[model samples]
Target: MLRIHFTDADLARTRIASAPDPLWEICASLHRMQSRQGRWAYADWYRGTRARLHDTGMVRTLRTLLLPLVPRAAYFPDFLTPPEAVDGLEAGVEAVLATGKERVRAEIGILHRTSGAPAWAPRLADPELRQDLVHALRRYHALAIAPHHDRVQARIDAERAARARAVLDGGTEALLAGLGPDLRWQHPVLHTRYPEDRDLYLNGRGLLLVPSYFCWGNPVTFGDTELDPVLIYSLRHEPHPSALPGDLGSGAPLAALLGRTRAAVLRTAATGATTGEIARAVGVSASSASQHAGALREAGLLVSRRHAAFVLHTLTPLGAALLRANAPCAEPR
Candidate 1:
């Protein structure tokens, strides 16, 4: 009944920016996981695991798997928790299988009620199944944190109650409007599961929020991982290249510094190429490349060091990451 207009693809782009390599890797890994597990079974296991764990943060990990399926019109309320976290890989499968069975009964009850039938009939018919599911969930909780179950449950209960109060008072709306001036609202929330910060549940908006740490977790995973080509179509492509600071800025000198030749020299240097190689690559003379490279070194995009007769150029960590993201993948493997 929710009037949600956004799709999974939209969720990926806004949350998973084109620049971060780790974001791309997470998406690719999830694509493989879903293909092996089958979709419905995975979803059922995910929800039951979260309910048992009683920690919503576990749900945030799911974005790693769900990234590739962003375009699909499916709703996975809590497929964020991986099986390994709940009960190890083997136990997680068993848990999912049991939860899938209970889910069938729950779905039937909801359907019957939606048809204007007596909800009691469905509940009565599935009483035993419901009881068994509760027992299984309790078992999950036991395996989850049996040693600290009392303390953990108390915390989860408190947080759950607080979340309920926030929903009742429209806390979501206030959080979105930058209610607190010092909330670091500009920090840009990445894929996360903090109750009030989940925009999907709040306003049914396509925008996603995640912690920055999650975005930059694993960079090389993108190159080795396979992704669906369909994501290319899902992206909102720009018709023309965006202007650089020099082109878009008000001052003429600043715009001139951001010129194409200068930018290309910096970009090549960012990739660890020498000035001579950069000039050859960019179709400029070596001396011309040297001039631009020096400018970029001054601007902090390139670090130049004299090695023998050659000046070695390499990007700072920040420069390398930025360049890698904007550059095209060498070939679709």
Candidate 2:
């Protein structure tokens, strides 16, 4: 059992990640590859990833190097999963490379003690070795994750949207209490059924709740309590079989009501596109795309924020909900 003690300050500071953490997904998927646990939810993904790795000629290298780093037990190196990875893959890799040599050595030593580290694991302290690891991670993601990125993103977005609604309907306590079956929220203490017994006092640093599409079974936290506090938990639902990229406009009634152009614009925003990019993607005039985006924003389906001179558009909770409700029955090609 893992007991997490929280304070009023910690409760106020608690928040959910806006998107999936690439590193956590990578680690979780690697663990899935090692065992048949949660096979019911991930059998298709597992088979597909294995075939992809074999076709891309990455099976042997990954098996020898990366697999050892992410064993199916306690003490995988924390440096491999940086807290800053919520931004994206490149940022996450940069964080991995920027890990202090001493920290890297210490984390590697822990892995060695808990689950024997590969001989080459010690060399991670070297900058070149770190870069190689990053390269391997990127390659694996490209081959294994990129193809299903949209499906994963859609599932995560839906879960976060529901959680957000919970917050609005019942405040922080409701949000915490509804986290999942594995977690039990009781006043200031959040109990989790962990592999081992442990306790974490928030100390007002708060916690970041990250939703992962691949993380299986119980929720996971950093082994080293001193690290930034986070709980990466599995999504409540598996990726819907029909949830595919670019299928947002397939809903006949929605497309008819909004027209193909505007509906396409809303779907494009689901993946976070700028106005100009949306224009190019939907083959519309920049001014026309901007107008459509404005209308969607007004309808509470899209939210646009200015980043420098460009206005980036992303789906709101209502928007994501609408998209999921209208997703096509057939998978994308």
Candidate 3:
């Protein structure tokens, strides 16, 4: 069991990540590759990734180097997933390279003690070895993760929006309580079903709630405990049926009713897209996209809100239900 003690200050400071943290996804996806624990949920992705790696001849290098560092166990080097990576992959890789030699050595030593990593693993702190690891990570991401990036982002967006609605409906406690089946929220404490018994006192530093598409089973926090507090939890697996080819074609009745451009805009809004993003996705001029979006909004299919200068468009409940009804056969069982 893992107990997280919180305070009023901590509650005030706690918040969810607006986007997927690339490094967390990388670490979690690597774990997924090594284990068949949740294979049923990710069967398509697993098969696709394996085939891609084999075709590109990256299977050997990734298994030997990267796999060792990201073993499916309690202790992997924390340096591989710095908090700064919330911004992007480049920021995360750069942070890994910029880690001080002493800190790198100390983290590797901890991994060795906990997981019995080989004696030579400590040499990863050296510049040449570190660069090689970065190269390997980039290659792995390109081969295994990049192809599914849109789907991954879509899942994250759906989860975040759901959580936000929970908060609005029942406040912060409800949001925390509904994190997952493994987590229980009891006022000032959040109890988690962890493999090891542990306690994490928030100490008013608060917690960062990160939703990961690939993180399986239980929520995970930093092993060291001294790092900025973060709870990386698995997002619920919701089938995105709109991604299917025939689901939104002009031949479909809904698409024909809405016209192909408006239907495409509505589909994109299911996972939340901005005006410009919707335009680029549907390959329409910005002005044309705006007109379609406005029509959808007038028709109660999309709700648009101003975030800074851009209008973020998301599907209304009516819109999502319509899409799902039209794509019933596309959903995973």
Top-lDDT candidate index: 2
Local error of candidate 1 at residue 229 (angstroms): 46
Q: Go through the candidates in order and give the clash count of each.
A: 10, 0, 0
* Ranking, TM-score, top scorer first: 3, 2, 1
For residues 68-113, could you state the per-residue lDDT of candidate 1 as single tens digits?
A: 2221212211212222223333344333334443554554444343
TM-score of 3: 0.76
Error of 3 at 264 (Å): 12
Top TM-score hit: 3
Show where candidate 2 strays beyond 4 Å. 238-333
Between prediction 1 and prediction 2, the one with superior TM-score is 2
TM-score of each: 0.23, 0.75, 0.76
Candidate 3 shows a clash count of 0
Q: Which of the two candidates, 1 or 2, achieves a greater lDDT against the reference?
A: 2
| Regions of model 3 farther than 4 Å from truth | 238-333
Q: Against the true structure, what is every candidate's RMSD?
A: 20.6, 10.7, 10.2
Error of 1 at 106 (Å): 64
Query: Over the stretch 95-136, how does candidate 3's per-residue lDDT look in tens digits?
Result: 999988998898888888877786678898797899999998
CA lDDT of 67 in candidate 3?
85
Q: Give the alpha carbon lDDT tens digit for every residue of 1-333 in model 2.
A: 889999999999999998888999999899889878777777767788899999999998789989999998866999989987888999999999999999989889999998899888888999899998999999999987887776677667656665765687778888898888899999989998888899999999999999998988888899999988999988755343322334454454343336888889988987778789999999999999998998876565666655335676777556777788889888769
The lDDT-based order of candidates, best leading, equals 2, 3, 1
